[model samples]
Each structure stands twice: as C-alpha cells, then as structure tokens.
Target: MKGEHILPLSQSGSARNTHIEDHLDGSSAAIKVIVFGGLDGILTMFAVVSGCAGAAISPLQTICVTLGTLLASAFSMAYGEFISCKAERDYVESERLREEREVEEKPEMEKKEMLDIYTNRYKFSSADAHDLVELTFRNKDFFLRHMMAEELGILLTEDDMTPVKKGLVMFGSFCILGSFPLIGFIGNFLGESGSDTSRIIGFTTTALFSVIGAMSLGYFKGSYMRQRRMISALMMALNGVVVGFISYLSGLVLMTLFPEASI
Candidate 1:
C-alpha cells in the first residue's frame, strides 16, 4: 500500500468527470439510432436494388419496388423502436417507484443495505459508512436515486430522449439514408429507359452510393466509440457488399426458377 499512489478524492472525481464526458459526448440514444439505423437503411436498400437488378427488372419497376419496401420498412422500424423504448422506460419507472415504496416501508432494512454496500463494496470504515448512509437518507429523493443506482444499476437521467423522439429519429434515418440506393435508379428511369447498359450503370451507381452511405455511418459510429474510423468504415462497407451479393444471387435464382414471372 505504500507505493499504491491512490488518487486524491478531488482528482479522482475530476478523472471520473472527464471519462464521463468523453464517453457521453457523441453517445446518445438519437445518435446511436442514427448511426445504426442509417446503416440498416443503406444496406437494406442496397440489397433490394441488387435483387431487382439481378432479376432484370425494368428501371421504373425497380424504383417502384424499392420505394415500396423502403417506406414500409422505415415505418415498421420506427413503430417498433417506439414500442420497445416505451416499454423499457416504463419498466425503469416502475422499478423506481417500487424502490421508493420499499424505502418508505422498510427504512431500517434499506439503511442496513446501504451500509453493507458502502462497507463491503467501497471498503469504507464502519463509522464512515454509517455517517454516509445517514447523510444520504436525509434526502428521500437522493436516497431513492442512490438505491436505484447501487441496487438496481439504473441511472435515471432527465437528459435521456423520449421514446417518441427516438422513434422519429429512427424513421427519418431509415427513410433518408435508405434512399441512397434508389436515387440512381429513379434518375436513370426518368432519363433513359429500357437499355441493358443504362441498367448496368444504374446498378453500379446504386451500389456506389450505398457503400458511401454505409461507410459514413460506420465512421460516425467509430468516432463516438473511440475506434479506428477507417477500419470501421471498411468493415461496414464490406458487410453491405457481401450481403448485397448474396441477395442478388438469390434474386437470380428466383428469376431462373420462374422465368414466366420475369415478364
């Protein structure tokens, strides 16, 4: 213990603050939804376009099909996000209320639990632990918060986004980022119709745009996660390419199996 060099309390607090700031800076529910949701959007649209191209569908038909899938999927993702987040928030709220009830009905037991946590987990001396517990229990709200964190491992923060806001973010991310792959086909369909070369060009452009979008999302995610941005970007792009290729092959097989439906 002589050379352990334990940090002073103030310095330890500052270090914890710095760590929290670094981790929380770009890491929010909305940002997470945007990065991951956008990746989902781009890859899904890319796969859809690849499938249509492999099936030799008309450019106009491809545009229509992709739009249909994009809108439907976005709506589904948004609604699902809303319901799940709402459920989780509700659960946390319920647990907080339950903890408050326990604190009110069983004050001695709650105090004993807090004392045990401080003395056993934090290695506080018995007198210091008792003093800390008594001080904490003086404020009912603060005591409840402490119990929630130490016992339930839940930190209820007002800064958290509402379920509705997160859901809206998800919907927008899915729609806007997901539109990358469909843009090329729409433009090609409007300008030049019914040509093999134009179809090939459209497919090429779609794939390019989708990869860019996926890489951008990955880079943003990497920045927040403190990882190598280029590596993350490349990995995400690779995943999209691999999945899109498989989807394209599946489409080709479907087309082959039902040549009559190709018309």
Candidate 2:
C-alpha cells in the first residue's frame, strides 16, 4: 500500500487568515505617531490641570490653560514629525543616487567592495567571494539592493507613509485623546458649585482618565507592563504640574491687575 500523505496543520488554514494576520503584523506608522504623540499631550495637559486645581484656581482658568497647551503641543509635534521624516527621505535618496553614480563610474571597484563585504560576513574563500560578487554585479538592481541594505540599513522597496499624513493623524489623535481629561474636569465643575469638594472630585477624575490613557498607550506600544505604567503615570503628573503653574500664575496676575475680577 502507498504511504498516506498528510498536510501540516499550520498550512491547512484559509488564505484569508494568513492575509489577515500579515496585515495585522504590518505596523501602521500613523497609528504609532498617534499613540505616542497623544500620550505626550495628555500627560502634559493632565499635569497642568492637577497643578491648577492644587492651587485652588478656578476650573474655567484651568480649562483655558489646558486647551492652549494642547493646541500648541499638537502643532509642534506634527511639524517636528514632518521635518524629521522629510530629512530622512532626502538623505536616503541622496545616498542612493550617489551610489548609483559610483557603480556606473567605477564598476570594478564597486564589485570588489561588494565582494569584500560579503566575504567578511560569510567568511568565504577569496575565489568564491569573487564569483559571488560577479554574479551580484550582473544584476544592477539586486547589487544596489544589497549595498543599500548592508551599508545604509534601508529597504529599497518598502513604501514609507507620507509625513504629512503621519503629522495629521498624530495631531488629530492628540487633540482628541488629550481633551478627555479636560472634558471630565469641565463636566465636574459645571455640574457642581466651585467648592473644594467639587475641585477634588474633578482633579481625581482627570487623573483617573489620564492613567487609563497612559496604560492603553503603553500596552499598544508593546512596552513592559510595569515600566510603561509607571512612566505614563510620571509623565501625566509632570504635565499637571507645568499646566497648573502656568494657570496659577495667570490667575495671580489677573487677580492683582484687576482685584475686582473674580479669578
């Protein structure tokens, strides 16, 4: 009797499952920027609000300060991402063009260099290295790809997400996510009289939300659970202090300048 054939379990799944898994594994650059950038904004704003509340400032003033900070931070983050990506792309392209020109002008030298690189990596004999180098040089694209990968540490064919798109996604996510804690503060303040109890409740609520946001970001970024959680907490706390200081100072100034104005 003929031996029975068997298929591997891993190979038996539907192609759709494979496709879905591959897609999921592909990291979205936009999502990454949003997650990190949003965390930064939320942490900063939360710190500001906490500080203002600690100083016994009005909820309205705290809200104003948080909003201003959020807008400024988001814009700055977006612009920075754009410029950085643009610079990277420009550098990579310039290097690639220069390499291509070198290949045309000094084919034999470039071939020898490629041989040396591969020989050093694989510990191949000089004759075998020469043969491999000749084979690679016969295909310009493949030779260039190898050079780029080894020398420059860049993929020749992978599509980079547009910097503008990344910037917009980051800014939008930051504005929306960072606004949650502030919204909680506003809601609490508007619902109750401006008393110490109301202020405490508002601040506590804001912190709680900030913690949740940070934890979520950490998990999404594949960070170590304990470290990420603590880092997130500290960042948010620091933000609270900065924002609070600014709001308190503004309130003090306004109070001094117009004593009649209820700050």
What C-alpha lDDT values do all the predictions have?
A: 0.81, 0.70
Candidate 2: C-alpha RMSD after superposition: 10.4
Name model 2 segments beyond 4 Å from true: 1-27, 223-263
User: Largest TM-score belongs to which candidate?
Assistant: 1
Could you give candidate 2's per-residue lDDT for residues 170-257 as a string of tens digits? 7887898788678778889789687888888898788777766665665555542224665665565565545655754664566667
Model 2, residue 168: distance off in Å is: 0.6
lDDT tens digits, residues 1-263, model 1?
01111122333343347667556733466787888678889999999999988898887788888999999999999999889877777777788778889999999999999999999999999999999999999999889877777777665554446678878999999999999887776777777757888888888888888888888888988887779999999999999899789988988999999999985
lDDT of 1 at 257: 93
Model 1 clashing residue pairs (backbone): none
Top lDDT hit: 1
Off by over 4 Å in 1: 1-15, 18-27, 118-132
